[model samples]
Target: MNLPKPSLRVVFLLAVLVPLIGAFLWLALTSGPLAPVPVTLTTVEMRPVTPTLFGVGTVEARYTYRIGPTYAGRVRRVEVQVGDRVEAGQLLGEMDPVDLDDRVAAADAALRRAESGVVAAHAQVGDAQARRDFAGAQVARYEQLLLSRTASEDTAEAKRQEAQVAEAGLALAVANLESAEQDLVRVRAEREALVQQRANLRLIAPVDALVVSRDAEPGSTVVAGQSVVEVIDPSHLWIDVRFDQLGAGALRADLGARIALRSLPLDTLPGEVLRIEPRSDAVTEEFRAKIAFSTLPEPLPEPLPRLGELAEVTVALEPLEPAPALPNAALHRRDGQLGVWVLDDGGPRFAAVETGARDLEGWVQIRDGLASGDRVILHSRVPLRPGRRVEIVERIPGLPR
Candidate 1:
């Protein structure tokens, strides 16, 4: 080669060696064994995987009631707080009963006036009827007297006129009585309506339940039927879970389930599927399913959960009696498929298997590709070969008979 400049020669030499040196140094740093990642695993066994569907939701009340005035008014007093338990018809709060009291009193007074008017009307009816009978008798007597010439013709005519006047007066009295009676009826009806409206001013619990929320404070103006206090029947409370459609396939209406409170992780409540909301929400692509607890937890051992405490719910799926299962650590990803290292006669063999359900424990249900009594490693670190000799380090004690 022609004599090259020293800088050119040095730069060319540095370019090739620098990359090789960097590659070796990077490999050396990654291959260090200072602390081997220790992975704990278990051997394959027939694990009783209670097939379960996992869904996150909150504890909810099955029966909720919002207590408010049937007639709108200002809240005078709130007897209970948000967490207070109340019974059916128990007064949760009271509204400004002054206006209501005045209304009730006015209603009572009107009713009394109406009743008096009715009595007066009845008395007028009796008087009108008696006068009518008396007038008829006098008219007949006068007519006979006139015919026998015992009474003057003018006198007979006058008696007949008096009878007609009495009849007209009776008719007027009867009409007045009917009108008074109708007025009384209407007045009494109006009074009753006021009474009902006043009674509705006292907010009461519709069912025996815990008050989940209080929407109004004293002096707050609330409308009739406006929700002021939220009450829920603790016994009828249920969980509403939004689950992916694919996850929902494993569930059914009335299927057995187990519920764990977020606070009380150790305890599980027995429940049954109440229903699956048929329609999926378009935004979330999820549907809600409900499960009703068999009974309300009494004197909740731990803290009592609120209406919307996020919870993890697992639907109790049918147990796979004879389904194959394996240690979770043995599951290895390879060539875009799942495989596991099995100790074969030739050495360590790669077995392809499909998995079904997992219990969040170390065991997972093996759906396919593994036979009974097949030996598979629990945890592996070394890159496994299709056929490589392996030694069994430990076997699980008390394997299922």
Candidate 2:
């Protein structure tokens, strides 16, 4: 039996509908939501990784000297300006004397008077001694005359009393002399103290240093202990760096480092870890360290690194043995698990990984859940899940080509 022939309209509708459905399916599978995610892949390789800690720091002086007056006073004159190199014991500035000179002069005068008093007392003692000797001689002569019946007993007794009075005067003169000497000593001590106070008024450099700041100028009044001139040991500059505590387990003194100053970006100065601070920043969770230059910059950078200038530091730690490792970019956290999106014949799947130390070059050591030659996704166009399909690419768009 022959089947009924379809109409021309039906034949046209059938032809259009078939190609439309085919195009929709092709678009969905190739370039639409159902398409495979594009990604960059890296292989886990066996290699040694040199863990390095990166930190930000500021230039600081190991020894900072703040020159100021010991007493509150006005600045008289400043001998050094900011950026000036100074030698040890060089005078930096002076404070106003404000009658201090007069005080010292008065003490000197008092001391001189004391010395003159001492001289006068010595003369009195000598005169009193002579009078005592004369009176004693007269007493002996009168007693001898009385024994020979040529002088009376009253005369002899009177001479004896005169001698006793002379002896008392001598004792008094000697006591006066001791008083004058003590007064002289006290006056001398006051003069020396005044002289020392005068010396303190002059601000002097304590070491060979570079003047970093001049906080006060001529005629500026400052309180005691306030800084007038600030100097630092240019040869002993260091960076006060802070690194994340999580990555500072191996940090220690004597480790080599590279320093890049914000002012001099292109220059990488060689440095080393001078010391690790005993205290850590509890709030920021960072460890503090001091990094010193292995060799100071030749001729020292013009306008030497200002105190508090920013710097970037990278410290090289101990090298690790060869182990399975991959780019840190492959790491991911899913449902509180540290893992990576690993690619296999089946497809991309999340594999929980136990990670070890990471290095500055973006490589992380894989302790478990990965092996050498395993492929992992480094960068993906979209978030991935288990059984997700991916298309490998040389590099991802929007990143460095």
Candidate 3:
């Protein structure tokens, strides 16, 4: 009725194989390819989100002036250098007055000569008038003599003819005087124009400004309209920003902004949306905007923000009412569907979701297919699928704590 005792070889094989098989199963279930994926989780919450638009920008000036001569000339001297502060009408530099001084002197001389000619014409006119008066008196006297039978008719007729000639001479003299006066006026105008040209040669600042550039130096020849100095109104500085078109729907003027200059990354300056540019960048799919400092830093930052320097800008948009939302990291794309991996009593499942606006803090609005109190996978160590096994973690590796 008793069974036969097993051999030693059989016993040895049974002990070795049993432990080997158990070790294999433990490895497969724990750290092998069949193991559960580790992920962080979060619950959907109902709360208000203050959305913000972030954009990269550059420092710019609202008013820029290029100081140069109206006519082509060589630079004679430059009184101001780059970074100099200038006031309205401040002389910045001067252009070579090649022949302008000489031209002005010549015009003055012409004007004086015209005046002299006018004076001479007036003297001639006076002499003609005296001659005319003498002729008239002689004609009147001769007519009286003729009436008294003391003068002949021929003599009376000659005196009358002489009076007519004198009258013509007086008229000619008056016309010459008028011509001289007109010449004098023309010369004066020429002189005034020359003086203006001479004044223009001295480059003057058109406004109280800070000189940002010196384009031409002394002895440098430049063409008309070429810049010798470039300046900008320091108080009217702004940033030219570009934001993603997708998040710019709520962008508007007067919205509050925070600007971080590349040079001063640790400090953020207060600013506001000056304006939204009508033109958008089609190629980059971005909206252009102007952001101005609400109040400049007191005493200004050492080494002021240079024009064209890069900056990071954040514009505060209208706050959203309380709504069901979850961390944007929870959203995922699978099988051409936007969704989140929802964890439930059954298991992890893929739930397609409709999303709305997102905020700067990484929260996204859940318009549909999700509700408050629902738990979802925020970040997973690997790609997720329906019915995938997962392990909830407090924090995922390689992510911010």
Query: Where does candidate 3 stray beyond 4 Å?
Result: 1-50, 122-163, 298-302, 319-323, 329-338, 341-343, 346-348, 372-401
What overall lDDT, based on C-alpha atoms, would model 2 receive against the true structure?
A: 0.92
Worst 10 residues of 3 by lDDT: 296-305
Q: All models: lDDT?
A: 0.75, 0.92, 0.91
Model 1 lDDT tens row, 1-401 = 89866798789989999999988877655554322222223456765776668787888877777778877789989999977878887899888876667777887888788778778877877887787788889889989998899999998888788788878878887887888878888887887887777777778788778877899999999887898888887777788888777646767798877788787789888888899988878888787999777666566433456678877777866666766787667788888889787665746667789987776555678889886566676654455566533444444343321
What are the C-alpha RMSDs, in order, of all predicted structures?
11.2, 6.1, 5.3
- Point to the candidate with the largest lDDT: 2
Task: Give the alpha carbon lDDT tens digit for every residue of 291-367 in model 3.
Answer: 99998766555456799999999998999999999988889888899999987763688999998878878888999
- Candidate 2 is scored at a TM of 0.72
Clashes by residue pair, model 3: none
